[model samples]
Target: MTIRTRCGAWLATLLLLASSASLQANTPDDQLIVGMNMNNLLTLDPAAMTGNEVVGMVVNLYDGLVELDPQQLTHVRPALAESWDISPDNSTLTFRLRDGVRFHSGNALTSADALWSMRRVLHLNLAQASVWKSYGFSKANVDQAIVAPDARTLVIRLPKPNDPHLVLYSLAALGSMVVLDSKTVQAHAVNNDWGNRWLTTHAAGSGPFRLDGWQAKDVLTMSRAPDYWRGAAKMQRVVFRHLQESQTLRLMMEKGDLDIASNMAIPDVRALRDDPDLSIDSVQRGTIYYLAMSMKDAHFANPKVREALRYLVDYQGINKTLMAGYGVLHQRPIQSGMPATLPDPGYRLDIARARALLAEAGYPDGFDTTLRVLADQPFLNVAIAIQSTLMQAGIRARIITGTGNQIYGAMRDRQFGLLVGRGGSGVEPHPHSSLRSLVYNPDNADSARLTNFQGWRTSFYDAQLNRMIDQALTERDAAKQQQAYFAIQQRYDQLIPALMPISQMVDSVVVNNRVQAYQPHPSATTFLRDVWKTPESLAGGTP
Candidate 1:
């Protein structure tokens, strides 16, 4: 049979299987399936993966030094390393490896493994630059990870005395510092590309779960590792199916075919909240939804045009209408809850002010412009709202929709005048990653230099960011550190590189009552290690 015919047959089989699967209570222990609305898996390689879905899947299969508690923002507990100590001078951090931990290949983890893993992150190739830069490690210092006399001890030497957050950077490096079998990596060193080739499809971690099988853009299946350091995971198997649309996911959840579903549409989320049979988990995430303008675009170069466009936005109205009151209107890049030295300086929606600014910029009647947006329904709705708002202010704005990846690529290359996108940091939040990627030159500057979308470059802002980074490294006073962060936020507010609509986005997770200990984090990611099924609930418990 042809390849297309074979694929078609497989799809038919999946449909039939899905139909027959029992999503209701009293389902057998081995038949439970968790449905999720995840898009295409960008990459299986932890180093190369960037999307939240892919990272979430990988998180279950890999172990890091510290893990975040979903309920508390500041709390971090041990995962791979049982305990650690920092030198008084703050130049050295020593981690003691957890005993009895073994990789998927049955190799015991040692200090050498941790050293190799962190060093590789520091020297990450082009394919993994996005993940690596988030660790706040300079290339020179990363090359200096050293092992102590004890085989179980791993020490990282800093160039200078830094702060606790800098050390915490290691814990929250996300896909960057995942420990790998040192022997296997060395054996394959001569023939493999560490970041792109070997690690992309194959993983050897000491996490509770192991990668059993993976099919691109389809399903990724993992099973509990029997010899996991913390003991065998309670759930025998975990499957992640890449169902892209919200409607299909909701349908599956309603039919009792999925035990958990995330990223629900706003309307669907509201419905799920009222559903008697489902328990909905919702959290306001620390992600910013904003419109990015290409600084290199001549039309946006005029400060008056930029200010007018900012004024033309009605963030409150968009939050109320599109988000169904689920979003918080944000004024600055930094969200409100974050401990910073300054408060948010909110924006104003003044039609008269916008028109005046446009007139002053030599366009009393406004001008024509195009804004690229994601083809997703909610994002499109937002784009349409923005377009209408701008038109009302005499600016002729058109919305062009495409896949998220396509729009992001165009925006990065400065090929689009304006684009609506989201920006965020992981559990260990930091601004350097976005600063380096969005503001600085692209990875390969000699070829096609990626210009900062807002063309914003001020020595003042740069100095503030630098000071914050250095203070985050060595400062011990919590209040003082927050002051520095506040200053950084104030600088960002002044620059207005991007108009932030919402400080936080609402993420919803729907799960069957049978599934216990399902927790959601502000990052909109879950640590599924502690998730388990209750026997009583599985045995025909009432909804």
Candidate 2:
């Protein structure tokens, strides 16, 4: 039978078995299945796909040079490389490789391996620029990466002084700097490309888990790697089954079939909160939901028109009614708590102001436009509310809803005039990546490539962005970084490319109490390596 059919049958069997077992008290040794409403997984190649599903998988399967502590924000800890040294000039960095680490392919991870991997990532030109953008390496700095005499040491020479965050970006986050086994890749080259068909289904990392099997749009099964650089995973196997329907996911969670679940709909989230049998872990994440306007489109080209649309958003109302007070009203594009950038309260609702701005922009009689929305109920509700608000100012808005990828694709291609979508500054949040990916040209060639839908580019904005990046990298003084951040924020405020509504949205995961040490990361990605089934629970005791 097909994998999807097998998974479906497996789930049905589990449900049936669990129902019968529930006649008596349940035990924790049962499978800890997790449910999700994710529909955006395309590839497992870290350098190829930037969707959350791939990210979720990468967090579990791979290790970076550095990683953020799951419980804290902005703290960095070593992962692949045990330690490193930064040169006095701030241009060159040397890393001390961890000994005895082996890739899933059984090849020893040497300094040469690190160098080869870095070279591949630097040259591969994946669509996700955020991976390497922080390293002060652009198309210009690609040649700066150098290897030392011994294969155990790798060095990255920057054009100028670099921000420490650059290191975090390359080693952490969804950037393309993931190290791979070059020999294995060459030997198993499907189309002579590491990121081609073979790598898409197979994994060859030094991580704790190895890809055993994967069924597209259905289930992904990973088993513990015996030779992982760290220790082996406590659990022998992990299976990711695609349960796109929220109700099905909730039902599974209630039936004790799931160990973890994520991306629950807001109402279902509320319902789960009240269930005494389940424990829900919620965090206000960096993911922001907003309306992306096409600057190239004539209807939204005018600054006043953009301002009018921004003014009509009832952020407070949406937070109360739709989101159930779950998310915060986000203002600036680069989220709060970053080193640089001034936070603005953003545009508030003022129907009079919106009307006046529309009139001033020569749309006194209003205009007809389409607002493309995602298929999700919450996003659709927000779009409908926006449509109604626009109508108050004589603007006729047609609400269009489609699957997440379909709507997102339309927005990226600039096929839609306006789109309701979600984006973020990212885990290792930075302004350069956010600005370039969404508002400017995305430098990568993969799915994460931020297509500039508006087709808006200006030398003035470009120069300012470059200056801000230079200052952030070169300036060691706190005041100077803050000053540069303020200047960039001011420029972005005036530019006003996207209409941002909610800054940080709450993402909740329901985990069984038997699952010990299930800490959530600030970036909203879970680390399954740190999780284990409690001893008492494993011994057939109730959690």
Candidate 3:
């Protein structure tokens, strides 16, 4: 058969599979087959998780004391611990574990398991270790910090009186403070690896679902827990197929083989915007897409030249056309809707002004520069738009593209001229979370590799900004904290660092009409807890 003919037959097979799945949904939809690009998933072990995809999957397979509020993205709500209490000094937090919760291994959930899970994260010092590090956590002091008076009572004492809001918010984060059945984990432990090897593929938690199967860079499937604490899951199983190609996702979405098309191409999303069978939903993410200048490059070292590039960026044009309504102009490290975020300065594209600035910077004939971007749209297309505008001011710009790691590794190594990156260190919806990770840098030692702090990656450091971040984080008064954050925003604008904030990221997910209550959070997390299917739709052969 020809290529097109073979492709048609392949789609026919998927449609047939989808139809077969519907035959098993007579009792409240047995499954939800989702199409996603899951190549970024690294590990199923909560402490080793780095990708949001892994976190989302593990979220269903684990539970923390607290969780992000379903409706309010910035707030927290109870999870494993039905209720909690605080000491008068604000340094001690105590939680009361819900009774009768059971792990997949039939072990009962308790405060002992909660303490063990956190200690494991600290002992391993893995991906989520920083959450504890923020509060003076150390391997030597782990036992003193977390205490379990009994199986039902868990308490944590911080070295300092930290903000309760920040503390709870940090704990609510997935992969940060999730619990594991200590007995099950330790039973499989070998040579102090803390069951990290086995837990990477297996789960030991009292959660909504239990891991059924996982294949790296391929597929991950989960079945509803037999006795979930809340109730039986709405869907019996969730199947995440690794379908990276947008064309394949689009065809599957059209054929009702996939329930949700996550990571859909902008062009495909737009084309299906008006389709009755599909629904396109979007949320303004906390990610900030920006251009960073390598301080090592002499051309970018000039202040006026850097300023000229800011004016050269056509944010409106790029957002309207190339981004296809998936980009919002956000010009600060502090994400929009944040309390201390100042009004955008609204710098318009003025070629005459850019030319004047470039001349003042001693480049009367403009200069040549390279703009590094990832080999993907939105990044590649946005870089092209920037190249077009910079040329008007005689700036000869070249675009270099590479895979995600190749480009990020270059940024980490500080070996590029200029690069456009998407970051969310400042988007924890907290000023300290944003500033410390994006703009504040106090340590520049060879031993201090704050890789999560993108500001450190750009080789930009200011002593005053460093002190300001420290003050803001420690200030207890609400008004003063807000002022400190506002002040940093103003100063960051005046002394443009290695970054030029362009726009905030907006995520688009096209789902079938059968997918109800499809709430995609600001962090780009997908939750199906409240999602249900219509009886008729569930019985239908097609989505």
Of 1 and 3, the candidate ahead on lDDT is 3
Model 2: pairs clashing at backbone N, Cα or C within 3 Å: 32-259, 33-258, 33-259, 111-151, 127-444, 127-445, 127-446, 131-175, 330-503
lDDT by residue (426-464, candidate 3, tens digit) is: 435577666766786666553577666677777777789
Candidate 2 lDDT by residue in tens digits, 1-543 = 564774566566555545754663333342334566546777777667666667767767666666767666556677777888888766677777777788877788777766666665555566554346544456556655556557667777765566656555546665355667778776776554654466777676777777666667776766667866677677665667689877877877776667787877767766787777678887766566777776657878788898888888887777678866346666766666566646666567799999999999999989998899987767888888888888999889898888866887776565677777776544555554444333443232334433532223211124555556556556767687667667766776776655554545677778766777778766645677756776443454433
Measured against the true structure, the TM-scores of the candidates, in listed sequence, are 0.86, 0.87, 0.90
Clashes of each: 8, 9, 1
**On a 0 to 1 TM-score scale, where does candidate 2 land against the true structure?**
0.87
Arrange candidates by lDDT, highest first: which order?
Answer: 3, 2, 1
lDDT of 1 by residue, 349-464 (tens): 67999999889989998888888898875678888888888898888878888886688767655577777777544344544333333333323332433223222311112455
- Give lDDT for model 1: 0.64
Best by lDDT: 3
Model 1 lDDT, residue 359, Cα = 92
| lDDT of model number 2 | 0.66
